[model samples]
Target: MAAAKSGGITAYSVKTKTKNVPMVDPVIDVKSGRYIATGKDADGNKMAAIMSKATAESHIEAGNAKKGSGWSK
Candidate 1:
């Protein structure tokens, strides 16, 4: 994988509710190889959020391109 640009990685905050009480914390990136988001719901239930490799790459490329000079610029 190409070296992620400095500060490219970001942590997403997730909130969980305990007995109707909400608890917020930064979600940890725990995948051994690549980063992925997975865990239970606020009530502690199994859930999955997966994205295709090609889709991820396209997003990254779009981001980098956006931080550049366009024809209008």
Candidate 2:
């Protein structure tokens, strides 16, 4: 998995599931130290943005996404 990039900053997006259904769009903003989510769905509600990460073991972890993999530091 690749780190999400916005304006040259690295970040990670993780999705939480409930009963095999997506519940929220959890995003970790690296440069700003902010964890944001679009919140749960409500009646007649629409999400502005949706981002998610894979759940496989081979999938990139949130920590790795934030740190990147091409450098040693």
Model 2 CA deviation exceeding 4 Å by range: 1-31, 44-73
Q: How high is each candidate's TM-score?
A: 0.25, 0.19
Model 1 residue 32 lDDT? 42
Q: How many backbone clashes does candidate 2 have?
A: 0
lDDT of 2 by residue, 5-73 (tens): 331212222332222222233333322332323323333232222223232112235432232222223
| Candidate 1 C-alpha error for residue 29, in Å | 6.4
Which structure among the candidates has the greatest lDDT? Answer: 1
Off by over 4 Å in 1: 1-48, 64-73
**Positional deviation of residue 35's Cα in model 2 after best superposition, in angstroms:** 0.4
lDDT, residue 45, model 2: 32
